[model samples]
Target: MQHAIAILDSGVGGLTVVKEIMRQLPQEKIIYFGDTARSPYGPRPADEVRLFTRQIVDYLAQFAPKMIVIACNTATAVALDDIRRHVGIPVVGVIHPGARAAIKSTRSGMIGVIGTEGTIRSGAYEQALKRISPGLQVFSLACPRLAPFVERGLFGADEAEDVVRSSLEPIMNVPMDCLILGCTHYPFLADAIGQVMGPGVKLISSADETAREVSAILYHKGLLSESADIPLHQFFCSGDPALFKQIAQTWLSEQISITPVIWQVPNIV
Candidate 1:
C-alpha cells in the first residue's frame, strides 16, 4: 500500500496546497482531512486550536502517512511544534514557507501579512521573517471575517471585492511591494484581493512554496513515490460533505480529472 501524505486543515482553504501538490508530485497519493465543522479557527483560543489539531492528527494517523502538512495557518501557529512532537513522520506547516516566500518576493524589505486572529497574535510570520532577515519591516493584520466567508464557498460572489477592500483598508497605503496571504483560505479570494491591492503589489501564497518543501523533503528521505500508476486521493471532512465536495471539485477539477472520493468524518469532531 502507498503511504500517502496526510494534510489537515480547518477547512477547504488547504485545497490551495493540495492543488500545488497534485501539480508538482503527481504520483504521490494524498489523504486530506478538513475540519470544516470548526471552520474558522482564526478567533479560537490557542489551546482550543491545539486540541482540535491534535484530534485531527490522531484521526489521520490511521492512514500511517509518510508525512503530515498542517495546512491551516492558525493551527500551525499554535500546534506545529506539538504536532511535530506527536507524530514521528515529517511535519510541515504553512507559516515558515509563507514567511520565506514573502521575504524573497519583497524588494522594499517591507512585507504585509494578512491572516487570522490567532496567526497574527502569535507573530509567527514576524518571528520567522526577522529570524532570517532582522532588518525587514513587517505589518500584520487580522482579518477574521474573510476565512468564514471563503468557508461558505462565496469567494466568487460579486460582493467579494467589496469585502476584501474593506478588510484591507488599514494597510492599503503601507507602501509594501509584496503582500503575503498568510492564511491558506485567503488564496480563494486572491482575485478580489489582487484587485483591491492593485497592480503594484505582488501577492504571495504559501501553497506553492509549501508544496516545493514537501517535494524536497520526500526526495531527501527517499520517500518519493515510484509508482507509475495514477494514485487515487482521499478527502475527509468533519462537516457538510456537500459543501466540501463542491469546493474541492470546483478548485481541483482542472488538475485532477478523476473525481475525488470524499468521506464525511463524523467521529473526528
Candidate 2:
C-alpha cells in the first residue's frame, strides 16, 4: 500500500512530526494539514476539538492516505478516536509514544510534561503513563502562548529565554528525570527548555517517537511507500498560507507549497 500519508495538527507543531517521518520514510509522499485558523485547540472544548480534528481527517481522507497521524497531543488526547473512526484509516496519535518514551527514559519515575493548556488539562499523557506504570509520577505544565511565540519566530531570541525559563521553572525544580515535550511546538524551544531543565534530564519529543510508530504501523499494514524518486509533500493551512509554509520549512527543514483553505471538509471518517 504505497500511498501518501496525512498528518494533522492545530498549528505548526505537527511539522516536527512530519520532519521525522520524512527522514525515516523518505519515499513517502505527505499532505500535511494545519488548522491555524483555529490554532491552539488546547483551550477549546473537547467536543469542539474533536469536531475540528474530525473535519481535517475527513478532508485529508479524500486524498486516500494510508494513514493519518495526529501530531498534536491536545488533539490526540481529545480527538484521536473520533478522527480515526471518521477517516477509517490507520490513525495514530502522539500521546502513547510520548508517554512510553518518557517512562523509558525516567530513572526517578518522575516525568514532566509541557504542552498546550488543552493537553495539560486533558491529562492524556498522565493517563498513558499511569496506565503503563502506575507508580510513575507525572507533572504537567501548560504553556499556552509558547506555540504562537515560536510560530512568530521568537523562540531563538534572547528575550524568549526568560519566558521559557519561567514557564518551565516548576517542572525543572521537580525531581523528574525525563521531560516529555507533549506539544509538537515545544521542541522549537528545546534549547531553552534544556537549559532550564539542566543536563541531567532527558527531553523527549513526541515527534520522533510518534514518527517511529507511524513507520511501524505503515510497515505492518503494508502501506509504506516505495517510490525511489522521493515523494513530494504538500502543506495546507486554514490561515495565512505563506506564514504556515514559512514555519513548515523552518521546522521540517524543507520548503514546500502551502495553500490557504476556507475549511477542509469537517466530518469524521
User: Considering every candidate listed, which one attains the maximal lDDT?
Assistant: 1
The digit string of per-residue lDDT tens for model 1 on 103-124 reads: 8788899999999999999999
> Stretches of candidate 2 above 4 Å error?
254-269
lDDT of 1 at 19: 91
Per-model CA lDDT versus the true structure: 0.91, 0.82
Q: Any runs in candidate 1 off by more than 4 Å, and if so which? A: none
Worst 10 residues of 1 by lDDT: 255-264
The total number of steric clashes, by the backbone 3 Å criterion, in model 2 comes to 5
Q: Please report, as a residue range, the 10-residue window in candidate 2 with the lowest summed lDDT.
A: 258-267
Q: In candidate 1, residue 130 scores what lDDT?
A: 99
RMSD of each: 1.0, 3.0
Candidate 2 per-residue lDDT, tens place, 17-128, comes to: 8888878877788888888878878789999998888778767766888888999988999988777667667889999999988877888998888998888898898889
